[model samples]
Target: MLLKFSRNGRTTKALSCLLSEGFKRNARPQQAANLLRPSYLLFSPDISFLRRPSLLVKRVVCWLSVNYQISSNSWSDPMDTNEASSCLVEQLAVDPERQSSSPACPNDGDEKESVFKGLGILDRFLAVWIFLAMAIGIILANFVPNAGPALQEGTFVRVSVPIAVGLLLMMYPVLCKVQYETLHRLLRTRRLWIQIAFSILLNWIISPFFMLALAWAFLPDEPELRQGLILVGIARCIAMVLIWTGLADGDGDYCAILVAVNSLLQMVLFAPLGVFFIQVISGDSVSFEYAMAAKSVAVFLGIPLGAAILTRFTVRGLASERWYDQVFLKWIGPWSLIGLLFTILVLFASQGRQVVHQIVSVVRVAAPLIVYFIIIFFATLFICYRLGFGYKLATTQSFTAASNNFELAIAAAIATFGANSDQALAATVGPLIEVPALLGLVYAVKLVAKRLGWKD
Candidate 1:
């Protein structure tokens, strides 16, 4: 009704009442009023979330999980802690009471879940498993050396199995962590390419010669010793370099790009370089066919990598840093180490006797690898100071060059010459000294960095 009031104040009061009546009949008015309502009046975020059509389904599902978990009898049941932890995973992170009634959604519980997973994976001992596997391989090589005969006819698993698996481990986890967007963003910096070029030069060009030189000093005219040193050089470092650089605060984006590029390039060139190094250093004929076969088998690297890519899609939003932390990193984190341990157990079962038999060979190979580390580590620092590469980048480049891809070398050794080969045995020793030695360097670099008035 169109109504007029006698007083100005009374007219305003009448219009307010009339508008309130109209709001009760209209959805637009009702929604607007809901927004205008005070915090104490309603849950604001809930309303906003409700308006987001895409999130509606997830919210509903999360809502159900939260309610069910909060009310379920399952939570009270007795079981081993591991079993209980697995069960908790099913409880989607959606706390109703904790949910803000505000327009923005609270994603705390979701984030917590992901962090739980990611950290679990990171905390694992995948390398330990691999290390133990090497020890096992040595034992088998010495003990049940007969098994090597069964695969003597040469099949993919014989050649490619370990290489492929190691490659997969080497490749996949790194790929899983890689964000194409990050790489695209990282490409803007010419410094990253500079670091990469520097890393590659040290890794391929200079590192091999140094290893050869060290081997020459320690073991000239010793084919076994020289060949072993060459393998270490050809493989180069994939893991430990990142660790040292990470400690030194090298740019992670640049480091990541470097790892990806290095891994790919190494795969392509390792065989040829390995062949060349053996020929030049040993002046002996080696098997190109056998090396190719080993490379063929080395394709096992695709597994974890394939799984990682699939997982990104299957578990959708968890790739984001927040969700990754909240959801997946912890549980899968340890699988690599676990896988490595299991692999070691198998290798020990398979190659235990061989390693024991060739204990002397293992000892002999260490001289060069150790010397390689010392030389590169110091040289990198010197170069950094001279070229003004800074401690962070220099330290990173040094460590990457300092470490060798032992897993690849070991697998290639086994694939090419058979599991019981002395060269393969030498390759396995790489990780034995690498992890501990590199850690020591990390501390040492920091100490030296402090002395130099560098704040890393």
Candidate 2:
């Protein structure tokens, strides 16, 4: 007997087959609201912690708040023997070049990995992989011809089935890595408010306008491309900013606050801001259902966030928070990278024909994006410097503002427009430009830190 299941009024032979190939569902906003009603609040990154605080925890929380300042010096204490040992073990897991430069520390057999140990070969060479994926996708689209068309069938909410699955894979692990429990202690600091205000100014006020200007200035003839860029600007980075912020040796605690705030804000502001900006710039009436945008956020951002929170709670309950973070999460975190690469492959393959046909246009779209990253980085850096923030916080702010949530943008584009629309094409181009460009910025930050003697 053949096993089959029904979803969105369609029957499939097997869930796993659809999962591997691709599946689509036309989830509407009301449906999303109903589906997420019980756990909608869980979408906020502030809602869950790996472990609940005990009587002993209250004291620790109080002590931390009383002593903690937003400055790097306040948080960057001298590593204890165990921490240093863990750092050394983490160093040994990477390249020989990185290993030779590793700092000295005690060797404890059970030493845990550094929080930043999650950045491995895959992350470092992400741009190269993305470029190769794009090429392979284009090749497949040319030879197979049906490859792209095949994935487009049975679409729901305008998102391709393969793209939907790939997105879920890319996001869940990133959320799992966040230490949401630390966010409460972080909220107590005046420095956090300063960072929050500064982040808001950049993400909402500055970044959106900046992207709008660039897209309009560069793509006068291509309204779809312009709209796509504007859509990207409105949705701030929620997930992968953690990776960039972590790799740059920024304050993880502060970054968590920024991520949480942006996640909440995206739900409220993304659709309005997107519609407002796109209409103003295009001078063309744009029709976008807020519900569709909300649905996309609910499925892509909300679902992964909920899963991560529950997973953290369960794992920490079974073992300790330390094991969850260091051992289990360390193993689980790479799935994000795997998911990212797979998503890239599927994303490019689906759009390969269009990208090849519009190669020059793609390059033109990328030009403004490259400029946007550079300008935002330095602009944010200058503002952070003027605000008297230290290097770690400054860099975190810079990165958070500079990176866009391309996944969210892509999902919204497909949901609002269609998978094959120019908007989706523009959204897909974002990660392509960002991966290598942002990686370069990471090294620049490290070198600057070394020269300034601002230790992480």
Candidate 3:
């Protein structure tokens, strides 16, 4: 018989009373052992054991060994039913007291406390740092004009050199945290395939068209801004989505896989999609350099991913897995945030002049972008939630859908239109809007998850 444990004081007391009566009638330890079987012990839903099944088994074994004075080696020893009944009854009489005193299992509160308090001060206040970085970047850009030019001076594959470095630093640690060895298992699952199909549908088909409609509706008179918005729509995110996913406590492995797929697709689809959306649909002739887009993908994603893989394998080879996970990961983890802040500073500084001079235009452009982000993010989040994709994967799907590859967008705009053109300015505005918007969504996702009881 499967006996379930509910989180109710009366039910627990009744169960204890029933167990006492059964023990008085000389119930065997074998029956007690069967009751404690990992498969049979149906705990309250809120317990930590529900999240970690192995932990459940370990705790059960530990409880039996400690409370019943059973040796681990003799756990399988068969006792004569008649001889062991009195001892079993005595042990069973105090079973409730033993369980209440046992420290073998963690409760829901302990689990939540550990998970929530694990983050350091930097992680806890990430939004404040990002906002401060933006303000500092703009101040530096306006006060020190040379800073912008110097930061933008050298370009590696159409990305500014400093930005390239920042992207690598930002992505490397996050990618390293992904369990790449487990990716094959995820790839074999139907759920992952479903997620990929949904991502492709939302990102390529639905999102681009939605942004086009919004662009037209909002900026009817501004052709350059409209074209820029369309370009932003076509270039799906490959970078920084990982950071947002990590911040939101989403599935990093799955997010990395989606980012990889998007990068590959961006190289193939971006140029043609740009032509179709901008030239054909909007009647604006814009030349998209396919090579530039390809180069940007290679620089932004390829380098960091390759480095992360190498680092992961090499460290695992030299040291133990525990050392790599506990020591090495902690060492390198903070750099991702450092890289993020530096990237934000440089990004806003580079575009600060345009942001200041064209404050009114930035606001107008920002309105639709903000709407697009919030709409796409929450819509995808709810759809994934209702589809039963749980919180982690659902958050991954939402952020991936909402984020735009602004690097690709900016490079494409500049190569197609002049650097000083409205299209370039609009493209530059993508990060300005996306940074805070998505950061806010990270917090919003947590709140929604809590209120709805969404589990990992």
For residue 401, model 3's alpha carbon misses the true position, in angstroms, by: 0.4
RMSD of 3: 10.6
Model 2: lDDT equals 0.68
Question: In model 3, which runs have C-alpha deviations exceeding 4 angstroms?
Answer: 1-116
- Residue 83 deviation, candidate 3, in Å? 25
The clash count for each model shown is 65, 1, 0
Please give, for residues 249-287, the per-residue lDDT of candidate 2 as tens digits: 787768877887888788889988876887765686777
lDDT of 3: 0.77
Which candidate's TM-score is highest?
3
User: Comparing candidate 1 with candidate 3, which one achieves the higher TM-score?
Assistant: 3
- What is each predicted model's overall lDDT from 0 to 1? 0.55, 0.68, 0.77
lDDT score, candidate 3, position 357: 95
**Per-residue lDDT for 1-456 in model 1, tens only?**
221222223222222232233333221232223322233113333444455554454444533432233234232342233422222222211233433322232232322122112222333333444455566666665566575444334444444344334345544544455454457666778877787788788878898887877777777757765676677777765554554465455555566566667777776788788777788556767654444434433454345545766775566554565455334644344444444444445445444555566767767777667777888888887887788876667776767778777666666676666665666677766665665566567667766765676532
Q: Against the true structure, whose lDDT is highest?
A: 3
Query: Per-residue lDDT of 1-456 in model 3, one digit per residue for the tens?
Result: 112223422233322332333332223333334334333233422255566676565545544543353223243453333323332223322355454333322333333332334476788788889999999999998999898889988987776888878888988998899898889999999988988999999999999999999999999999988888888888899988998998888998889999999999998999999999988988987788888888888888899999999999899989977678767887898899999899889988988887899998898889999999999999999899888888999999999999999988987887788667889889988988999899899888987887777897
CA RMSD per model (angstroms):
16.3, 19.2, 10.6
lDDT, model 3, position 53: 72
